[model samples]
Target: MNKFNGNKFKMDYSQFKTEVSKRRRSAATRELTKIAYSTPHSVISLAEGMPNEETFPFTEISIKLNDGSDFVLEGNELAAALQYIPSQGFPPLLQVIREFQRKAHAPPLWDSREVLIVAGGQDGLSKALEAIIGPGDPILVQNPVYPGVNVVITPHNAELIPIEQDDYGVIPICLRKRLQEREASSLKMPKIMYINATGANPTGTVMPLERRKQIYRIACEYNFLILDDDPYHFMYFTDEAPRSFLSLDTEGRVIRLDSFSKVLSSGLRIGVITAASPLVASIELHMQSSHLHAPTLSQVILYKLLKIWGYDKMMEHFRRIRSFYKERRDLIVKVAEEHLLGIAEFSVPSAGFFLWIKVPGIEDTWKMVMQRGVTHGILVAPGAAFMADTSKPCNAIRASFAKASYKEMNVAIERLALLIKDELAKNRSILNGNT
Candidate 1:
């Protein structure tokens, strides 16, 4: 006979077990929700990879009716706030996206490629990945890539092969070598190659036109599909913005993902996928299965705004946002030169929101900084989160100039410099057996 303890209450523990099991398969993006909710302080969050909301052009936005009159919603944009529409999204919105793509990319008969609206660039990417990638298929991604892409690829049981990249974006020579090796081994060839050609995430590098052409040539030779994720295409502050792979893609092998989030409001969560008709159809089916479609109201509102303002006005707005971020980038670069250039190395980005800093000999920069620097109210994204394998050694950290004000940016950069100096001293002392 065994005596039972009263502390062990009689309950159906199996039911709780079942619920937990169901959640184990949930998407990794859902984990961010928990982190966002739990934090109390206003996180000077450069980690989200989101654009500055303050940059959106609200002043130029005005609604007009067909009856030769001005129209206004008391709630501002009710059409964007509340509505259920098409799975493919509003036709007018798709038409506007097509026109923008045509002028921006200068593709041959760019209108031939169809546009499908999605929840966000990530959503569009996930759907396209689902439609094309099967379990165990190889997906070639640049090393130290975007975390959102990692989230999508992991759950699909896809093999993520890391392609080496530099200041000019993915090195085509390295890519060709890797592809050839994989083919020689008789292993499955990569089904797709996902690239962020313009102002890449984590690493603020833009692929030059020559490099883009080289990569396109490799894709054609290898017979692998190209997923051109170009959210920051219009964010280039430099005079020479690189041509996209989609423009060079004669075989219709490139699927371009564009987002309004970078240049507009991220809260709207609007993105579009432009590709060949068959590929677009497959992506739409996946969208139908997942979300049915992007919000109808948001699409319509954007369409109306574009119709009234035109492309030139939109480009002007983009230039303003670009100037604002370019100043921030310059400020950060100045700080790094004064405080961290010798101790750390970084590339001066021509566009986009991030500054990728490399601190050699420190494998876990996040733990070192958070355990010490977070006490000073500074935060940064660890290099490991961007890598495919977190356990592997890495010496980089990603900082942003998008969200924080100039004053805050100055303070944060100073604090980061101090943290790096302290860590470096500690490492030196250990090497000398002084600690």
Candidate 2:
């Protein structure tokens, strides 16, 4: 060992710096270094990564306190909102979310599961993907899955084997068949199975209890983990609440993503991941390095809401929210039945924002959306967007009733019906010409 300045420790600037992996370095590194640590008082700078005070607009925000008095957010607290805080989150808020999770799932005490606050479900999922998946690793997904999820898996260069889904969500036989087939392939079998489960994206089919049990069994049999992405869990129209995979996971093989985007407000961007503590710790380390943490301000805001509302009051709030969505679901279904039902069959949509409708004659939605949806002033999400392979055939379209006004929903279905008619007419002409 060599020492400088005749001491045990030597100040070698080069030695002080440890090497970062090539993967850890990104295009952002250069951009982050371009900013000044302390701006001059005379020269006002606007290159910071925060919104302007005028844009923030709110000096004081208030929420009802426990006894119904207003709890105001301003002064130093407001400043804290603008400043950075803990990477885990605001300390008190993390505890609040922990309480919420315990009440929501009631997972066994011995299980050693925990929650990590995230920007949203997508953020939590991305971290999970990074933790569990890598190049050439195979991940199982429900076919006709959420396209965003498909996109997430793409950069990893991981193999995606899709399990088929019926009205009740993923079919057991299809899952088994795919697993068995993959077993024979030279490629590595899928080590993780992902599903939207509650109010599945696009399809809006809630995975029934028995189906979930069957899915858990399959995961056990295959010795794989389950990534249950259930954003619409609280939005269920059914009388009883759906059980989460976290509740069923005895051996800690499931990682669940829950979101407040739908239940609370989309802009809030607060989400939670409940999984075995070990997995949560791994994902947390990723969060610490990447995002550092979800916005501390948002977590503090959510904490106030939860504290004032409490568990029972929060449940009441959720009930009203669920009821509102149920009404929209009913109206949208009625509109579809009146105009587009015969032309395009769709599931009743027991939960979630969208109705996944299939047009019998159409082979793909890209053309259908172009010719009918746009021309008729009814924009739709092509089912192909949700497919694992976008090039695969997609006859379905996803229409969300959440943001659409009642009149828009009604008129949109009428336009869809007309579009279907045109496609049918074209098909008939082709058949006649062939004859």
Number of the top candidate by lDDT? 2
Model 2 worst lDDT window (10 residues): 1-10
Whole-model lDDT for model 2 versus the true structure?
Answer: 0.76
Best by TM-score: 2
lDDT of 2 by residue, 1-435 (tens): 100112121112221111221134222322332233223557654544544455565688676644565677887677656555544466577778888888888866423666778998889888777777777778889987887676777887878888888888989989998888877775576667889988899899888888899999998887788999989998998777899888787767788898889988778898988876656656665665787778877887888788888999889888888999999999999999999856789889878899999988878867868666677777888888888788888998899999888998899889888878887887788889953
What's the residue-level lDDT of 121 in candidate 2? Answer: 85
Point out where model 2 deviates above 4 Å: 1-59, 63-70
Q: Which runs in model 1 stand beyond 4 Å of their true positions? A: 1-81, 109-111
> Relative to the true structure, how large is the alpha-carbon lDDT of every model?
0.75, 0.76
Worst 10 residues of 1 by lDDT: 1-10
